[model samples]
Target: MYLPPHFKIDELAAIHAAMQGSRLATLVTATTDGLIGTPLPLILDPREGDYGTLYGHVARPNPQWKLPPTGEAMAIFTGPDAYVTPSWYATKAEHGKVVPTWNYLAVHAYGAVEFFEDADRLLDVVTRLTDLHERSRAEAWQVSDAPADFIRAQLRGIVGLKMPITRLDAKKKMSQNRKAEDRAGVIAGLGASDDPVDREVAAMIPME
Candidate 1:
């Protein structure tokens, strides 16, 4: 996450919000074999630590859990992103100095990785995760909706993960480095585009 000062996201609340908005995260860890990564949807426990705690799980048969991680793990959360064409910038016509760039938001959380298999803890974590995602659905679902035996059996096929986050690297590269006129052109261009993600990126860009 090579974030310049203008794009850095240092506020804890803002970073947490970005993570929550983008619920899915990629967990990356280094092992004797090589770097292993898994994309998982994580729930944050904001009260757990100075930074926060991440809760998620991976398939029981996944090799990532079997190998011991030699160093810290990283969880990456990505928000809306859009492609900015040089044609969208005012500078392109004036001096032809602008180039294409992407506007997006992302957060990287680093911490010690902990894997667990305790039935009680796994059940709790799974249930909470389910609730977090299902809360927004029109027809929300719950863990208990299934037969207890079936749910318990399903849980057996996975391993739980808990990482107490120690460091956060967040960036919102939303054309903040561009001049006011260039930024305005970018916003207007994206806002008019058909891609939903582009519109989202436009909404994130600060007024300049």
Candidate 2:
């Protein structure tokens, strides 16, 4: 995360929000065999430890969980992102000096990774994760909706993981470096875009 002062997100609440809002995260680890990465959904427990803790599960056969991480593992979370055209910069018309860039939000969490196979812990993690995502649906689903034997059988095919976060790096590159006029132009251009995500990035930019 190469964070310039203007782009760094220092607030813990903001960082956690970005992490929680991300639907998927990439978990990366360095092992004797080299680097391995797994894409999964992770739940952040802000109440645990100093920074927080991450909980998720991986398929039992996934080699990522079997490998011993040499040091700390990292989970990468990314939020709304969009490409910014130089044409959106008001300064581009004045001096023709501006180049295209990107606007986005990202967070990197580092901690010692712990993989477990305990059925009870796996059940708890899966239940909480299910509830978090399902709560928004008009007809929510639950772990208990399935038969106990089926749920227990399903849990056997995966392993649970937890990482007590030791470090967090968050960045929000939302054109904070641009002049007010240039930023306003960007907002207008993005707001006119057909992509809803482009409009989302537009709204995140600060005028000041």
Candidate 3:
């Protein structure tokens, strides 16, 4: 990933926060056949390593796990994004030099990949994933809610994934390159837009 100094996210805490906040991630790996990408939810164990470890799973029928990865695997996490029209930039009114751009946050984690199918590990992974997503609910559901035999059968249909993240690349491109007036215009324009995501992007922009 390209890292311009102005947009780079180097702080470990910030990088971890971005990854955790973006629940769904794109898992990519290269193989003898070609590049494969799967979008799924991944949980981070920040205590696993100097960086952290990633946990997730793929369907048993998914070909991605069948082939051996030629190199390192990557997990891509993305945060709120919004479209910025030229009309939102003050420079457009000044000299018609501005163009449309996007404001967003992203983090890429790379490491060795391992696949497993052990029932116990799968059960643990499934239970933890369920808990993570359901924690916000007033009446959170648990793996125990389902019949034991049924849950075991369900776990058999998927393969577990473990990746000890060796490195991370994070970036927050939130109109930081724009002039103050242009950024203010962008904020006001996005904040007033009909899309809730646009308003989210507005809140992410740095004012200082």
Candidate 4:
């Protein structure tokens, strides 16, 4: 994460918000063979430790879990993102110096990963993850809804993951580097975009 001073997000609470707002995260680890990445959902327990601990799981047969990690693992959480066109910048008309760029928010967490197969821990992680994703549904489902035997059988196919985050790096590039007029133009352009993500990024841009 090459973070310029203007684009850096140094506040812990803001970083946590970006991390929590993201549902899917990319877990990357270095290995003797090469680098491996897995797309998965993680639950952050901020109270678990100094920085925080992440809880998730991978399929038992997934080679990522079985492969030994060479060093630290990085979990990447990406929030709202959109493409900013040069047409959206006031500078384009001033001197034709504007170009397209991406505006986005992201958080990276680094830590040592612990993989476990304990039934109790696996059940807890699965249950919590399920609840988090299902809470917005009209008919929220729970692990208890399934038969014990079936749930147990399913749990056998997965391994739990726990990473106590040692450090966090967060960045939000929302036209903060541009002039106020250019930023306002970007907001208007993005707010009128066809993509919902563009509108989301527009909403996140500071107006001042």
Arrange candidates, best lDDT first: 2, 3, 4, 1
Model 3: lDDT to the true structure: 0.95
lDDT of 3 by residue, 24-121 (tens): 99999999999999999999999999999999999999999999999999999999999999898889878998889889999999999999999999
Q: Comparing 1 and 2 by TM-score, which wins?
A: 2
TM-score of 3: 0.98
lDDT by residue for model 1 over 22-140, one digit each (tens)? 96899999999999999999999999999999999999999999999999999999999989998988889999987899889999999999999998899999999989988999998
- Pick the TM-score winner: 2
Query: Residues 2-87, candidate 2, lDDT per residue (tens digit)?
Result: 98999999998899999999999999999999999999999999999989999999999999999999999999999999999999
Off by over 4 Å in 2: none
- Whole-model Cα lDDT per candidate? 0.94, 0.97, 0.95, 0.94
**Candidate topping lDDT:** 2
> Model 3 RMSD to the real structure?
0.8
Off by over 4 Å in 3: none
Give the TM-score of each candidate. Answer: 0.98, 0.99, 0.98, 0.98
Residue 144 CA error for candidate 2 (Å)?
0.5
What 10-residue stretch in candidate 4 is worst by lDDT?
A: 9-18
Worst 10 residues of 1 by lDDT: 199-208
